[model samples]
Target chain A: MLIKRPDDIKPSDITDEKIYHQRRAFLQAGSRAALAVAAGAVVPGLMFPGEAAAQVAALQFKKNARFSTDEEINSLKDITRYNNFYEFGTDKKDPAKYAHTLKTDPWNVRVEGEVEKPADYQLEDLIRESQLEERIYRMRCVEAWSMVIPWVGIPLSALIKRFKPTSKARYVEFTTLYDPAQMPGQKRGVLNWPYVEGLRMDEAMHPLTLLAVGLYGKVLPNQNGAPMRLVVPWKYGFKNIKSIVKIRFTETMPNTTWNLSGPQEYGFYANVNPEVDHPRWSQSRERRIGEFFKRKTKMFNGYEEQVASLYSGMDLRHSY
Target chain B: MMMYRMKPALIKPLVFIACLFPLVFGIWAGFTDQLGANPIEEITHRTGDWALRLLLITLAVTPLRRMLGWGWLLRVRRMLGLFAFFYACLHLLTYFVLDQFFDWDEILKDIIKRPYITIGFSAFVLLVPLAVTSTNAMMRRLGKRWGQLHQLVYVVAVFGILHYLWLVKADYLLPLIHAAILLALLLVRAWYQRQALSTRRTAPQTS
Candidate 1:
């Protein structure tokens, strides 16, 4: 088990290798001063040298929270954009190709509509204000592919809380970056431009909902949304909007691209419950590419304990 | 007439070069990993597209030979027809071996369940007889019946176009272009055959 109840090793135990070597040498010297301190000394927490560099170099966000542990950092790296984000391009591989041109710098997210503090926030400011946590998530793409990834990002709840949504704001609407001058795909209208996706406010604020910044222990590649993206792990890949530019707290449900294209096929919730099948294909089994054969998809991608209750009263068939 | 006989051999090198070009490109692309994540799909699509195009060229020969009064086209028809089969085989191999991993069960299901696969498989199966009988020895053995047997290429061509048209989710423009070319070539053949029949009827009076 890579993670064993978190207490097996403390950060101070793994501090600068040079200092630890000196401490070890002093202990070996059998000096009275070293021995006196060594007897009741508190273990100094050690951080990877790279983490120190990252902490200093990392652009200031809402709060100065570093990744809690290295394990969390590694997990964040694996998930972000392994699946296709096709509003950017047609091919499954296209997102990585076409999204490279996306400018994530100077990102100002418009948090407007029914929120009490309806204001635009710079991405850097938004990050500086919140706590970033690492969440290990099982991501399932609608195309029947799955991956386990660790994502580093502030929780969606942290970002949403700043806006202070009014009681009338029943749903939250998210819009992707859309500029035909920069994004050529938007010119052809393969899908509705300014690709919109939505979630109920409670679902939006779920602890599992992540506003991801980096993957694989590094800042996201431009194709993977360089600065920030939404990661709704239990839902299909498309529900995880990339390079978001707008987030509106709305009273009515927002029209999503997939839902608008074919309302009968794509429902708003778009949860990854195998019980609900896509119009063209069955979602019962998914092929994790690295795995040889079919692996049964878990209900809500194994976050049933956290998310299953949200859909309890509603008929999944209707919501599907 | 003596000089014209020497000119025909010049076409052999041209024919050989044309035949080798696609194979060279396909091989080079495969070796260099230029086919991206799904090389087999790229190879399959390229070979399939070439096969359909060559099949169109093969069909065009008869109408061209009749209209231009150039009977020399009959000499190259076998070579072009074989090239179409060559690419078609490669197309099918890519799909069956690379794409399906030779899983006979899945392939059988695809053939039965998918209409595009059914059309394509039928076209390839029809091509086998045409390819087998393309030789001069078989042509001599079959005699006049050879023409009737080779008529199967027309049906194969139609199915080939239909196979392509059915597989696409959108952007029907490419298949529609193929269909238009095929219809025009078939119409020209029908017109040429009618002209030949009328010419045969008037031959005695001219003599």
Candidate 2:
């Protein structure tokens, strides 16, 4: 029972994998064909054009070059196909293979807890109200692999200011969409249903933090955490929770999924410190998604200039 | 009885070809750039998977021989053992060459200190003598000692399975499957050994 019967669809309505590929072949001459053909393309979403085109509508945003990395970004194929969205499935490829089933058409984000605005915000209205910008950032996984992703979204600071947290709000906790019907992986207890992640209020309000709505100038692919996901550039990849449904401004430290799974391996402040190796493997070096030889991993994934001051006095090794 | 009648000469080549399939297919996938985003990781995992799979398959042979009463299956066991060693070599090569990039200092550190790697590396090292003593000439030279030495395979199997168990992050599905298979095979072998000992004790000894 690796793949359970999805509740949303009648068994007959489900597209067979064979016929799905055949249909992709039939539509090969169309716009979606570019993804199937874009083998070495640098853009992230091109590799999943079918998933992108079926649900992802294009977005308009200003390019913030000051914050964006000049380094060549990994192809959309690499970013979209190679993911750590455990909600979709534990395998990196599972998201792209199965995330098409996630119904995000009428999505909403509930902003609760200590926030002044405690209401369910529609995904569309929030995107429209927030000032969107495209920022390219390097995301390093705890597994010692890295990817340069150009994300289109509003800064977390902008969204935080709009929400207006109360005095007691010390942490911002995020929760992923939870529906076993849409997310087949949720049916199994991978890391407790409804993945949870939290950041200190200051960290959440940092200028670099992004609530990414799209990727590579297009709506974020479902596999890549559409209609939106949190992208914390300086922290390990797991900190960037995807397919977020709830944002809670809390007084106490919230329990994150990975930290709860393995407390020794993961920490509350999972800043990418190359010095602090994971319990199982070394983090001194990371293989960039498209590169051959392993390169020396940098402190805070090369965002030390912007984020170092945030943890200036704190011992990263202890926090990690 | 029918399987025992099957010619080893005919089956040996097929087994050899079957053992080589994973390597050939992995190379084909590599050349096509179909190994996905992280080709190095993909290649490492594929090779490691085949190595463990072959090891498990090799372990299965003894129990199958006893259970089905196909004593002739022993003739094929050496080739399977060697193939397991061969894939294990490829698996180590992938990690050593592709992942580490000849970084001996790092490799040595991993082998010496890292529990998962330490266990896996020790298992691979244990496999070397078993592979070396597998030849018919060496088998005859060592005589009874050969059987004692090859018992190391059972220890190697435990280490190999433990290596996989420790390495996986959260998904224990595959490792658990491998553990179950190895456990069943070992249990069956132990049961057969006890049965053999009891039968020998009861039987009239001409010697």
Candidate 3:
């Protein structure tokens, strides 16, 4: 009986694809359970195991989409656990611990202001019409940290086009859910209550922008902004608002949360430009969430070729 | 008085090991992978926090001695100050080695440019001389100058708090707490100095 080390085993001896995938799925579920335990949440093991499996099975999205990046997708645990959703709290782990109270089901998004169809639409109905695509994007935070995430969503353009923006709509404003009972952090005046973010009309209509519904092939965990969120890869993560409840199109530039909080620190155009440093810290380098060494932050977070044209003549230093 | 009743040899070693506990815990946390999701930031923050905390603890020794009449507290003051320096060194090393990876040009630029980094780096630079001259022989050699040289700790503490305040984007609760503690400590020292001054004047008139 010879014991073969992992390195000594040849590719020919590898497990079958079906078995491998099944094993991977089991590991993923086990890790999620471990994460729940780590966060001091009651383990869902008492519930039917089949029910959890069925939920995972039902979450189907097209794979290897054209928009997906080649970068390694961050672990599902990291994506779910490490978050900056201030609605829950300021600490990174606060959201994972406190976001359980949020009720994402029966959610409705009200599209209003400069739109032809100004009415409340069910979140499910909005997602049902758009084709879901898996996009692996580099998400750079204004805090000088980065993560590569595989997001499942439809292009934001698809959702915005449905509302039919009038010619007067030159800017788009997004609002996060604002229930203090559910979101404990809202009790404190962290950022003038409900977090608001915005983008230029052309930027909102860009193909790269996504109205994310899920991540890592699962319905988003509450901490990761359940039901729906925004994903603007080229801009800072805050610009990609979370738990969005309303999207309004207007002729005037909307006042974003951070920009209002500290106008000197945060600007309207929160593009990921390394050359433009944040007032208190350098943006030239960013630590990839789990990695030890900091990497040079790429211009527009490496999507420069695609989105750089949007700000051809503008000074990023001033606008950042 | 209880601490004085104990032998200096035994108490000194105990204090030495106790002062090193934070660095040991930090190392243990790193090896055990318990530094959380962002290990670099966690390690950087932990070391920095310990450094500031120990510096404040070191500052509290004089007030504690005068208020509680525990002169033996002075014995641990040097050790506490050195431990503060030790953690400060670890904090700066983590930034240079792990965060910046010895990119001298970038590190230099950060020290020159970023206000938070500039103040933080200056605080570390000031600590280096105090740490170097911490030995009994140097204290003996410098005589009264040693006390004057070590007054720089107050300035270092100021920079440490400012560095923290500037770095955090929002939720300044932690830094504000540190600020309050520092303010109280400084006020206590000032109040004590005023008391000593008035006592000296009264004694001369009475004589």
lDDT by candidate, in order shown: 0.69, 0.81, 0.80
Q: What DockQ, on C-alphas, does every prediction get?
A: 0.15, 0.67, 0.53
* lDDT for position B185 in model 2: 92
Q: What is the interface RMSD of candidate 3, in Å?
A: 1.3
A best-first ranking of the candidates according to their DockQ comes to 2, 3, 1
- Candidate number with greatest TM-score: 2
How would you encode candidate 3's per-residue C-alpha lDDT over A123-154 as one tens digit per residue? Answer: 76778522555678999999999999988777
Question: lDDT by residue for model 1 over B1-207, one digit each (tens)?
Answer: 344366988665677579769889889987985654445556778899999999999888888887777667778888898999999999999877766667787678678766889999999999999999988899899999998998888899999999998875334668989999999998988887788899999999999
Task: List RMSD in Å for every model shown.
Answer: 10.8, 10.2, 9.9
- How does each model score on TM-score? 0.68, 0.89, 0.87
Best by lDDT: 2
Give DockQ: model 2: 0.67
lDDT of 2 by residue, B1-207 (tens): 454266656677777898889889989998998899999898888878888888888889888977788776677789988988988898899889988989999999888868999999999999999999999999999999999999999889889889989998888888989999999998898899899998888787744
Instruction: Tell me how far the alpha carbon of residue B9 in candidate 2 is from the true structure, in angstroms, after superposition.
Output: 2.5
Judged by whole-model lDDT over C-alpha atoms, candidate 1 comes out at: 0.69
Task: Tell me the tens digit of each residue's lDDT in model 1 across A87-201.
Answer: 5566545655566556665677889998899888877677741244445566787766676665657677767776878878888899988887556667665677888888887
Local accuracy of candidate 3 as per-residue lDDT tens digits, B1-207:
455576766777888888888778988988997776788888899899999999999999999899998777899898999999989998999999988899999899989989999999999999989999999999999999999999999999999999999898888889999999999999999999999999998998999
Query: Clashing residue pairs, candidate 3?
Result: none
